[model samples]
Target: MHTTEHHWITTPITADILRGALDLEHTEHGVLPHRLPARARAQCVDGQLAMAESQPSGVRLVFRTRATAVELDTLPTKRVYVGVPPRPEGVYDLLVDGRPAGRAGVTGGNTLTIDLTTGTAEHQAGPVGTLRFTDLPDSVKNVEIWLPHNETTELVALRTDAPIEPAPDGDRKVWLHHGSSISHGSDAASPTATWPALAATLGGVALINLGLGGSALLDPFTARAMRDTPADLISLKVGINLVNADLMRLRAFTPAVHGFLDTIREGHPAAPLLVVSPILCPIHEDTPGPGAFDLGALSTGKLRFRATGDPAERAAGKLTLNVIQEELARIVEQRADEDPNLHYLDGRELYGQADSAELPLPDQLHPDAATHRRIGERFAELAFTADGPFTDRSA
Candidate 1:
C-alpha cells in the first residue's frame, strides 16, 4: 500500500498581508485588526465605537498562492440579544482572482449576550474555530478572505498546502468611506455583500470602510483618522447616525461638519471628496430622533426601531433627515467654490420614497441584503461612472 504525505505550512497573520485595517494589535490569542488606530481609540471610551470598529467590515487577507486547500483559525465574538432570535453565524468569503469562489462560517467562539431592556451585557467564553476551504484550482491566483462584517474576529492562524506570498499592490485607487450602521453591513448577507464592498468591486477601487454602527457622530477623532489615512477617493455618509443618536442640534451640527471637512482637507488637499446625506427613511424624515426599540415588535422575536422625538421638536432645533439633507447641501455648495474637488450627492438618489416602497427596511433602520445590492449598483452607476463625483479622471 502506498500512502501520500500531506504537508501543511503555517503562516503568521501580519499587517503586510492584510488590507482595509488601519492598525493591527497582537492579542494573547491572536492578532486583532482595527479600523481605527490606537490613538483614536484611546480618545473616546465609548463601547459602541469600540465594538463597531473591531468588526472588520471591509478588512481582508490578500495573498498569491497555488494552494488547493486553506485553513484559517479565528476567535469570533458573536452578539446575541436577550430576547430576540440569535443572528446567523458570521460568514467568511473566499475570492479567487477577484471573484467569489467559496463561503463558510465559523462554528464556536465567544458570545456577547445583551439585554436591551436593562442595557447590560454578559460575556460567555467559547473555543477558537477553524474555517476550511478546499478544492481550489492549483494554478497561481490571487486569493482574498474577507472577514465577517458584523462580528469581531481575531485571526489566530493561517495554514495552507502551499507557500503563499502577499499579493503585490496594483494601480487600483483606494476608496475610503465612512458611515452609519447601514454602511456597516447590519443586515447584509455577507461581508462582501455590503454596499461599499460591492461598489468597490464595481468601481475597481480598493476599499477602506470605516462604517461604525450607531457611531458615525461626526466625532473629531474619527475625522482625524480619516484625514491621516491615505486614499485617492473619499466619501462621508453622514446624517443617519447623527439623527438617531440625537447627539447634537443644528446649532452644533453645521459647524461640526465644517470642522470635520477642514480636518480631512488638512491631510488630503486634493483628493476627490464626496459628501453623502442620509437615505430616505420615512420614520425619521419628518420626525426627529433619539430612536428607540419598538416594544411591540419585541414580542415577535425580532428587533425593530422607531423614532421617539416629536415632529414638533424640529421647531426647537431638533435634527431630522430633512433638516440634515438641506444643511449638508448648503455646506457642500458653500465650500465647493474654494475646494474644486469637493462634491455632494443627495442620499435620496440612492434610496428614496420609491425605493422604500419596493424594498422596505426590515428593521425599520437597516436595509436588507437585496436593498444593499440595489444601493451598491446605484452608487456605482452615479458616482463611479460618467460625470459623477467619484469618477476616475485620470482614466
Candidate 2:
C-alpha cells in the first residue's frame, strides 16, 4: 500500500500578515499582538488594561494562499474564575474570501485563575496548542484566521500545505473603535462574531477594535494610542465602563471626554468622529456603580453582575447611564458647531428598552450572542447607510 507524504511549509508570524493590532511583541515563545503600543502600555500599571489590550479583540492573520490545509501553533492564556464552572475553550474563526468557512478551538494552553472576592489572579503555565483547518479549494483565495476576542494569544507559527503570502490591501476605509467589555466580545459567539467585526463587514470597512474589557476608563494613554493609529473613521463607546468601574465623577468625566476626542482629532482632523453613549443598561441607568458579581449566581453555575452603588449618590456628582447620555449629547452638540465632522449616537438606538425586553442580558451586564448580532445590524444601518454619520460623502 502506498501512503501520501505531505510537505508542510512553516511561516513565522509577523506584522505584515496581521491586521487590527497596533503593535507586535516578540515573546520568548511566540509573537503577541497588542492593541496598545509599548509606550502607552508603559504608562499604566493596571493589570486589567494589560490583559485586555493583549486579548486582540479584532486582530486576525490575513494572507493569500491556495493551501489545502493550515495549522497555527499558539499559546493562549485562558481565564478561570475561582469558584464558578470553567468556561469553554476560546474559538478561532477562519474566513475564506471574506466569508466564514470554519471554526476551531485549541485544547492545551496557559491559564490565569482569578479570585473575584479578592481581585487577585494566579498564572499557570501550560503547553502550546495548534489549530488545524483542512480541505481547502485549489484556487487562490484570501484567508483570514481571526484570533479569539477574549483570549490573550501568542502566535507561535503558521504551517500550510502550500506557500502563503500576505494578502494584498483591499483599500477599504479603516474604522477604529474603542468600547467596553460588550464590544470586547464578552458573550460573542466567536472573534469574527463580535459586534464591531460584524458591523465592519456590513459597512465594507476595515476594523481596528480597541475594545478593552473592564478597562475602557477613558485613560489618556488609550486616547494617545488612538491618536497615533491611522484610521479613516473613528468612534468611542464610552459611559458603561466609566459608570461600572466608578472611575470618575461628573466633573472629571466631561473633561475626559473632551480630551479623548481632542487627542483623536489631533491625528484625524477631517475624519468622521462618532461619540456613542452607553446602551440602555437598566442596572446602571439610574444607579451608580462599582458593579459587583452576584455571589448567589455562582452557586447555580452562572456568573452575573449587579450594580452596587446608590442612586442617591447622583446628588453628590456620581454618574449613571442617564446622566452620561445627557452629558455626551450636550458635548457633541456644543462641539458640532465648530467641528462639523463630529457626530454623536445615543447607543440606545442600537440596543434599547424594547430590544432588551426581547433579548435580555444573560449576565445582566453584557449582551448575549443574539444581541450582538442585533446591535451590529442596527449600527450598520445607522452609521454605514445613506444619511448616516459614517456615510461616504466622497462617493
Candidate 3:
C-alpha cells in the first residue's frame, strides 16, 4: 500500500572541503572520490581530507550504494542502512519520499533517529546520517536525500525490499552480493569503480554490497545480516582475511564456514547462494599464513619497518590458501545435498595462474586500483551471466 511520493532526483555534487565538522565514516559520501584508498595517497582518497573550517557538523550519507536504484514495483518497501559516523549532539530533520520522516540526531553517542510519521517537509535536517522508510511507491523511481546543514555525512550501507531495477525500463533482476574489503572497495580509485560496482554494471542487477573491510570474518552477525536480507542471487567471498588477520586455524575454518552457511540457510533456504574463497596471493597461496615479515625489512632506526610473512608458516595445514580451498570443497560438497541451491566459486580462478605473475600488494596484501578493476571484470565474467553469477561454481 504505497501512495504517490515525491521522487528526489539526484544532482551531481562534487565532494568538497567544507566549513563544518568532519566525521570519518564506514562508507564514503559527500566527497570528490567515492572510496578511501589503502595507501592514503591514492586517487580516490575522498574521506582523507580534513574537516570543514567551520565547527558545524560536516555530514556524509554512508549508504551501501553510491546511488540507490529501486525498481517500480506494485509496492516498493525498502529499508536502507547508512552507517553512523561517531557524532555529537544535534537534531537533524530527515525528508524521504518528499515527506517529513522527522529529525534524528545524536545527543551523545553516534546514532540518530528520524520519524517520518510526524510531518511533511521538502527538506530534511542536515547532519547526514542513516535512516529507514517503508511502502515506497512504484512511481518513486529515485530517492534523493538532503543534508542541508552539514558539509557531508558518511552513507555506509543500503538495502531494499524490492530488487534493484535495471535502467531505461528499470526492470532488471535483483543482484545481491557479500564479501570482504575487496568487495567493500576499501582502497579503490573511486566509489563507482570498486569491483562490485564494476560487476554490477556488467550484470545489470541491483547490488547489495555487504563488504565490511576488516569485519568480513564470517561472523554470526554477518551471516544473520545476510539471512535477514532478500536477494534473487547471493555470493559469499570468504578466506584471506581469516588467514591474513590470523582469525582462526584450519581446525576452526571448516566448522566456522559450516556455521556461517547454516545461518544464512535459515532465511534463504531456496535462493542460490555462492561461496567463494580467496584469490592467489604469493604470501598466502599454497603457503601458510599468520605470516611474519622479513627481519631485514626493518630500518635500523626502528621508526619505520616492513616485514614479510614467514616462509615456514606454510609447512602443511597451516593458514595457507590451498588448505582453505580444500576445506571449502569439503564444506560445499557436504552441504550441497541439504541445500541444493548452494554453490561454490573458487577465488583462484579469478586471479590464479600457472605463470603466477604476482601483483605487488603495496602493503604485502590487498590489490591496487588497477588490480581491483581486473578482479571485478574477472568476477563479473565468472559470477554474472552464464547459468548465474559465478557460472563456474564447482569443486
Q: What is the full ranking by lDDT, best candidate first?
A: 1, 2, 3
Q: Write the per-residue lDDT of candidate 3 for residues 1-395, one digit (tens) a residue.
A: 96645344333332222111122223333332212222322322222122211111212232222233322111111111122122223334333432444444331122224222232213233333444444445443434232322222333333454433222314555555656666766446544456776686677655556564544577665677577765667889887777766767777777889898888888888777888888776667755545453333322211111223554765544576777888887889898987888888888777676414656565555676787788888878877767764443452
What's the distance in Å from true for residue 139, model 3? 15
- Model 1 compared with the native: what TM-score? 0.98
Model 1, runs deviating above 4 Å = 1-5
Total clashes for model 2:
0
- How many clashes show up per model? 0, 0, 34
Model 1 clashes, total count: 0
Candidate closest to the true structure, highest lDDT = 1
- The residue-by-residue lDDT of candidate 2 on 184-259, one tens digit each, is 9889999988999999999999999999999889899999999999999999999999999998999999999999
What TM-score fits each model? 0.98, 0.98, 0.56
Native-to-model Cα distance after best TM-score fit, residue 147 in candidate 3, in Å: 14
Note the residue pairs that clash in candidate 1.
none
How much does candidate 2 score in TM-score?
0.98
The local distance difference test score of each candidate is 0.94, 0.93, 0.51
